[model samples]
Target: MMNDEQKTDKKQRLIRKGKKVQEPVNTQLVVNIFEGFTKDERDLTQAHMGAEYFRVMAWIKEEDEQETIGVRSFRGFHQFNERLVFPLDCSSYKYIYIELIKVHSRRDPATSKGTVVMGRAKIRLPPWTSRGKFTSKFNLVGLNSDRCVEIKGYLNLSMQLHRYLER
Candidate 1:
């Protein structure tokens, strides 16, 4: 027979022994899109007209989940100064897909009224960068019928990653 304090101590020790120690988790990714440019060129000449606005869609696709992290809309052709942040487990995601769509409001019912994809880009985490802070340039491309067309617009993006111990 043991006293109450001894019994408590014994239970604590057992619990501590049975508990599995967890290592510090440091896996976090942050992305920032500062600005983009649509140059004045032959391919982008048609895009300038009837272009009400442009939007960016960012998402991460995983084996069991597909998540959209950010969507930003701007009403200009020269610059899209935007900021987006995502708190996600980077290891589980397969790839990050980004699409820049040009929007127009057309009264004609025969045409697709609202949104048209102007550019698309995909990034795989490991090979891109490890420093977690950098700027990248991506060319805008569009699809015409069964062919891919390169537009004269480009997107400038800045990305950062932060890792801290999880509580």
Candidate 2:
């Protein structure tokens, strides 16, 4: 025979078993986006001086959530010392994706939206089994005239995996 307390505990356990309880976020992925490089710069100093504006956007999903840096009018490189933190679940890890876009600055009237993807990069997550930090430059590639992908520039960033020391 079960007592009222035991019955209530059993019922609660059964309810919990029936539902999918997600694990608490015990880790975090920290990323510091530094700068973006451009391959060509002669035109920027000469013909296209101060005529180009670029923005670097980053995200870690196939979803709509994303973060973008403000438009920068520069000749050679784009600098952004932005940091983004993502809470990690124990289920799986996700990659950090980056995109460099050329934003229209009331000059170009070619595309309707006026944003073109100039370069792209994908950075893999740090190993979940280890706690460390990595800082390096990743190549950003784009399609050329014949549609063959080529290295456009580079994106410099640092990433670290931090796990909470649970008591």
Candidate 3:
């Protein structure tokens, strides 16, 4: 887990990155999480559950809409464990936004700081409606209360929008 200073530094860095560009850069999307069974958990579960998929529900906010977007999808265990990522299909939405925050952490056996991060993603634009690019950073501290094991990341749709609208 990162300290408060670390989180602040990261945000500052991102803001700097956003400001450095001469062309218009879109607002970024952030995603963060602290708790969940790792890939190791899938291996353990496969021994009994016999290869199953898990679904995650994420809350998303687009720049143009007042209502938030709720995305839920099934992910294969092996793919999830290997990639440590969940893909979202947002062809329908004109804009996108996401933020991940930790609710609580327990003190039992004691573990390292939780995984937190900020990510940038590019979704399918037009001709290619199946592929996209995603970049992210991990191991960040909580922004709300300075708690460890929290995750946060964001998406920059303007870059994607530019690429998509380019004709």
Most accurate candidate by TM-score: 2
lDDT per residue for candidate 1 within 1-167, as digits (tens), equals 99999999888778889687566767555666655654323344444344345567776643322223223434434455666555555466655677775555342224576665666777655432366577788776665545757564677877666666767
| lDDT, candidate 3, 1-167, per-residue tens | 99999999898778888465444323322223222221222233344332332222233334232212222212311111111222234435442333232111121114344212222222332232323343332222233334344433322222222222112
Candidate 2 per-residue C-alpha lDDT over 1-167 given as tens digits, one digit per residue, 9 for 90 to 100: 99999999998788899687655437877888888786642344544535666777777765634565665746558887888777776637558788888777343457787776778988888887767789999999988757898898988889998777555
TM-score of 3: 0.21
Query: Residue 73 in candidate 3 has what lDDT?
Result: 16
Highest-scoring model, lDDT: 2
lDDT of 1: 0.58
Q: What lDDT score is found at residue 26 in candidate 3?
A: 34
Better of 1 and 2 by TM-score: 2
Question: Candidate 1, clashing residue pairs?
Answer: none
lDDT score at residue 12, model 3, on the 0-100 scale: 79
| Weakest 10 consecutive residues of candidate 2 by summed lDDT | 40-49
* Stretches of model 2 off by over 4 angstroms after superposition: 1-25, 40-51, 71-73, 105-108, 165-167
Kindly report which residue stretches of model 3 are placed more than 4 angstroms away from their true locations once superposed: 1-46, 62-159, 162-167
RMSD of each: 6.8, 5.9, 18.8
